[model samples]
Target chain A: MDTLEQDIKILIIEVLNLEDISGEDIASDMPLFGEGLGLDSIDALELGIAMKKTYGIELEAGDGRIREHFRNVLSLAALVRHQGKGSLTHTP
Target chain B: MISWDVPIVRWVQWPGIGAAELGFIEPLLRRRLSSLARGALHVANACAQGCPSATFVFASRHGELTRTVELLRSLAHDEELSPTLFSLSVLNAAAGIFSIARGDRAPATAIAAGVESFGYGLLEAHLRARKSPAKPLVYVYADAPAPDPIGPQSGDPQAVFALGLLIQGDASSRLHTAFRPGTMVGTPATLQANACLRALERGSADWTSDRHHWCWNLR
Candidate 1:
């Protein structure tokens, strides 16, 4: 598994409090919300906060397309790697 | 008259709380719930098992004191309070969780009345029920000693305890309370919750406090 995928998985667990599920159980291409991990909108806001604090990737609180970036571990890993500029404010 | 002897139809209590039992709370809320809130919600859920539409009154002598103290300390140090802590540090935060969880838009209250919190809180619930006699009320009292060095000497033990009373208003008479200006010095337990539950369990006629005598007629 890619290091970014692993990091995102760990972040999701730690941020959302999914004690019932382990990181490895979250498939790289599996959906993250709704039909996937069953997390809701509040979980999204919390994840956004954690993402900014951890990766310094500031997500716009109202970005509709950003939902696509958070669709799965594969998508999130790509988002994190794409923003590898280390610490950047991402406003979409 | 320190008046209020409403009928308590059901009750739920947690003698001691552990984090493992709270796995059911969402991770977002779990991290935010103070020990006080965690204990209170645990018993609230239990007491309100079948009554989601019930009103609620949460009583505590010191609700979220530790969180408030932390915020105060941060302000003193010229540090910004953590957004999550700032949001959840209110006295009513824990009590409001019941309303949120149950999706009940009905009235919910959080109250503190020194050592007489339980009595006064129950009184508040009684008054609330009077407004709409059809709805039942759930009264919750929870307390946990504050975090270190702030009031350790004055604080209660580290134990987190909570009890919930379900008031159905079925009985015409149940409890009657009278206020006294001077302290009567009841048992060592300062929490009104402990006193109230003990009186119920032991079938005592009355529970005495420093300022009031609560007469229970559980017949």
Candidate 2:
């Protein structure tokens, strides 16, 4: 997996406390919500907080496209790598 | 019916410590402790993991609220506390971590009954086991007194301790517990976890421990 994808997977496992799951088990295109990874809204909020702290990118409530952006590990990584470039303010 | 009388197959104690130190106690129990048992202990100590240890009923009087308070204090002072500690500060943090670690999908509850925290937690665990006859539930109770500036001036420093009980119902080790409400004084020494262990060791049907001075009878 690419750096971004790997990072996103780590973040999911870390934030969600997915005990038995490893990055290898999470398919790039598998849906993270509902039956796929079984993640819920609370997990999204947790991920949002982690992203803001780690990448300095804030996710606003009205960002309707968040569902699409956080669909899976691949999508989340793409979003981070793209928005992370100029929008990030916190440096590690 | 679940039995509480089974002789304790194994018991290990880790007093006044964190997850790392708590890990040290496992080796001693390894000869008799099941993989599930060890996993429960690990999960109990490391609350971030979701697999709940097969806990009967867990209790924490102060819980890790102390960490939350510390984190808030650090935030107020613009200080950066250790992220790891901050993450583990939640009240149910340890229990949650243990649950994840053990991969126990069974029902586990944590209680904060103040001076009665330990007794109440035990009662809950005992009741659950009685209701379900299959397996012994692990019950762990621990606490760390508040720190200085907000610390209890007269209370014992480093009083933290945890007790893990694998409770089952059977004739030979059949155990019974009774509670009586009352008041007392003097740092509530009987409320200490060690005191409770002593009571159990002696096969006392009635005894008291630490601050929550209420009396309990266990056979």
Candidate 3:
């Protein structure tokens, strides 16, 4: 996996509290919701917030392609790279 | 005086003062449990063993107050709050998590009655058991001192503990509980739980508060 993809995987694991799984366990292209990681709507919102905090990526709630951007680690990394900025506020 | 012969079928407590053993819960869901929920579920699970389903009465004087305080602090700082934290920062969080984990559809009630949480929780369980004499009733009380500002003046016991009791409406052995108006006195929920435990082990325990007087006697 590329550096950005690896980072996104780590971020997902940390933010979602996937204690039993590691980055190696989550396939870069696997679906993150419903089947692969079994994450739900709460995890989606949490992951979105974490992304905003870490990568300064502001996701519009009404964005039709939001699901596509959060589809998997690779897609999340692409979103971060597309935004190309770090957090502007305290990352607490 | 309203009283009933409430029988305690089983009892358990969590970790003396440390983390509770929650191997039954999947790490995915368990990761969201706060320490208070962890301990409450730990004892509740143990007491509910062998029973297919049971009514649950979960009580805490300061249920998730610590987490609620943290969330409020985050909001005050204009920081983006964690969705997970906000979700679990409720008095009924543990009871909800327990029902989901067990896949049991039995009704669960959460109570926070100031210093009388333990007493009123058992009373609530007794009332529920009387209504449905067939189903088992589990009364679980867990509390930890809340962080400064919100709970310090409440006189909560400094220790953290969870107590579970399996209540049966009719049994060979019985516990007699009574309540009446009395002078108010502040007592910590932990001490109230301990007093109930002592009553079960020995013979009786009683407390006096400005609003009420509560007593328990194993008969």
lDDT tens per residue, model 2, A1-92: 57667677777777666765788988988999888977766566667767766775658789898888888877777777777753333222
Write one digit per residue (lDDT tens) for candidate 3, span B12-79: 87656555778888877898887778889999988888888788999998998888888889899998
Docking class of 3: medium
Candidate 2 or 3, higher TM-score?
Answer: 3
The clash count of every prediction, one per candidate, is 1, 28, 5
Q: Deviation in angstroms for B217 in model 3?
A: 1.8
lDDT of 2 by residue, B1-219 (tens): 122333343344554244433343422122222222333354344432322334457776777756667778878888545454455666566555554444556666878876567667877777777676555566777765666557742322265556666665442454445554435445444354555566566655344443333332244
Worst 10 residues of 3 chain B by lDDT: B182-191
Q: DockQ for each candidate?
A: 0.15, 0.05, 0.79
Q: What is the TM-score of chain A alone in each candidate?
A: 0.84, 0.85, 0.89
Better of 1 and 3 by TM-score: 3
Task: Give the Cα lDDT of each candidate.
Answer: 0.70, 0.58, 0.82
Question: In candidate 1 chain B, what residue range of length 10 has the lowest lDDT sum?
Answer: B149-158
Q: How do the candidates rank by lDDT, highest first? A: 3, 1, 2
Winning candidate number (lDDT): 3
Cα displacement (angstroms), candidate 2, residue B70, comes to: 6.4
